[model samples]
Target: MLEFRDVDTFYGELHVLKAVNYKIEQGEIVCLLGGNACGKSTTMKTVLGVVQPKRGAVVLEGEDISRLSTAERVRRGIAPVPEARRLFPRMTVYENLMMGAYTRKDKAAIAEDLERVYELFPRVKERLAQSAGTLSGGEQQMVAMGRALMARPRLLCMDEPSMGLSPAYVEQVFEIIQEINRQGTTIFVVEQNANMALSIAHRGYVLQTGEVMLHGTASELLGNEWLQKVYLGQAEATPAPR
Candidate 1:
């Protein structure tokens, strides 16, 4: 559903994404794995048009959306579950979810989508009147996912969906991600937890120092000696070629 072609991005003169290339097919869950400052989040921002590429293009469903505004991208069915779940602190949970539908005017469909989100996250429904900032980290994450689903996105872009949470919550969140993908919304996840990300991803890409170092199916990545030694912590494994 989305493809990045030799994309290069920068903040002033400091290059962040260097000729990064990858693709997310419709109905597939693709995860991008990397350590700190390796340009994982920048890839997400590039997809959402928060940062434009200096070279190459960001194509969505065959269209060159390299220059499209963020709003336009959202209208075209791109929704983000931003890192840290950036919800409106003072807004009620219900109101926060409604913001996801800001670009749409189909009242009935929006209501039905709201119900769908509630079904997916009963905790959110229970806390509809509660302020978003008052929820626990896991609850907040659930709200974030529900908010993205509120948009009825065709392709959901999730950035660090497991950034901060207990181990149990992390497993729960990844399970929910798989469920979402099973329900037909393609997912592109940027995560540091390579094991968890690849465990649920159909395919995975490893990004190191702003470049894709490896791209393969999930099982192939799991069996890669280099990836195991570095990301998966199999210290005894021999290094494989980049």
Candidate 2:
């Protein structure tokens, strides 16, 4: 549903994404995995139109949206749960959710989507009137996901959704991500947690120093000796199906 073709991005003279090419098929969950400074987050920003590619295109469906505004991208069905879940700290949970639908005019549909978000995140429902800043890390992440869903996106882009949470919370968040995919929204997530991310991904790509080093089915990557040694920290251990 989304494609990045020969994308080369930079921050002034500092080259970041290097000829990056990948595709996120419709109704599938794809993940980009790497450690810090691997250009994973930059790929997400490129998709959201926050960082334009100096070369190549960002295609949604069949059209090139590389030059489109962020709001236009959102309207075209790209909703992102950005790194750090940048919520409106002072706004109540409900109000923050409302802001997600700012691009829409259909009140009835917006209300329905709100209820749908509440259904997916009961904790968010419970904290409807609470300030977003007061919520726990896990709760705030839920609020972020719920808010993104409010936009009714066809493709959801999440950057490090498992960051800064307890192990239990991380598991819960990955499970929620799977559920979201099962509900038919395509997902493209960039993560450092390879084990957790690949456990739920339909396919995975390994990025290193702004380039794709490997790409394959999730199970194939999970079983790769190099992948295990470098990312999973299981050198000399046999690969087992997750």
Candidate 3:
């Protein structure tokens, strides 16, 4: 589980996150929804130790991880599938997945995890020797998720997993995410695909200009006529969830 309490993040003194607060319970899938540049990604980066928080704490399980290094965070059971599907373009699918488990020392366990990943993403298994860059966008996203899973994270923070994908691919990715959660990993995802996110999330948080504006169960957020207009895009909102 992860918790962000009154957290503030800055991009060179231009404070982007304004006292953000949220919690992701163990084995739960929580989605953070917000418009572009509203600090959703920044909040994630802070959790990953990519950007240092200027205020408050980023807690993992029970310890304060705000001051931990990114590698340390990853070693301490945190992994992220970034928005860009951050794969090494020239690397083979198998190689990309192996890189994720570099922090671990058990070769046998690593091999076992590799097999599990292949089972989770059969496309990756079929193209084990293929260059990651040659795969389709959806396949690449699957590889990205597989790579993260190889790390064996307790809490996986995925930033915009469905960004820039076709509707079918988006559905596929979301389904895989749900399956991942069902298998026991906690997930805290940030997404622009509000309908898909709400549908899959157990709980949801709406962010506006770096502040949490609404928090509710997925069904509650989805069924609310006002939220549907504001986020489900039935009507205009203050900013683009772009």
Candidate 4:
């Protein structure tokens, strides 16, 4: 449902994403894996229109959305669960979720979506009146996911969903991600945790120094010696051809 066609992005003179290309098909979970500063997050920003490509296009469905505003992208069915779960600290959990529906006017539908979110995250529903900042890391992440769902996104872009949390929470989150995909929303995840990301992802891409070095099905990536040695911490594995 989304495609990055030969995209290049820059931060002034420092090039970040170099000729990056990938496609996330509808109803698929595609994961992008890379080390620090390798343009994984930049890919998410480009999709959200927070970072425009200097070359090529960011296509959603069949249209080029390279020049669209972030809000316009949201209206066109993109919702983000940001890297740090950047929630409004002072806002109540319910209020934070409502912000995701800011671009909509249909109250009935919004209410129904809210109920769906509550069903997915009963903890969030229970803490509807609590300040978002007071929640634990796992709780905050759940709130973040719920908020994005409030937008009824066709493609959910998650940046570092496993960044901070205990192992149990990490497993829970990935399970929820799989459940979310099973329920029919396409997902494009940018993550550093290669094992967990690839475990649940249908397909995966590896980026190195701003370029795609490997692209394959999740199991193929898992069996790749080079990927295992580099990202999965299997130092004894031999390198494999890209």
Candidate 4, residues 1-242, lDDT tens digits: the string is 89999999999999999999999999999999999999999999999999999999999999999999999999999999999999998999999999999898989999999999988888899999999999999999999999999899999999999988899989999999999999999999999999999999999999999999999999999999999989998786557879
Clashes of each: 0, 0, 0, 0
Candidate 4 deviant stretches above 4 angstroms: 236-242
Worst 10 residues of 4 by lDDT: 233-242
Give all TM-scores, in the order shown: 0.96, 0.96, 0.95, 0.96
Clashing pairs in 3: none
32 Cα displacement, candidate 3 (Å) = 0.6
Taken over the whole model, the C-alpha lDDT of each candidate is: 0.95, 0.94, 0.90, 0.95
lDDT score, candidate 2: 0.94
Worst 10 residues of 3 by lDDT: 233-242
Over the stretch 1-242, how does candidate 1's per-residue lDDT look in tens digits? 89999999999998999998998999999999999999999999999999999999999999999999999999999999999999999999999999999899999999999988988888889999999999999999999999999889999999999998999999999999999999999999999999999999999999999999999999999999989889997687657989
Off by over 4 Å in 1: 236-242
lDDT comparison, 1 vs 3, better candidate: 1
- Model 1: lowest-lDDT 10 consecutive positions: 232-241
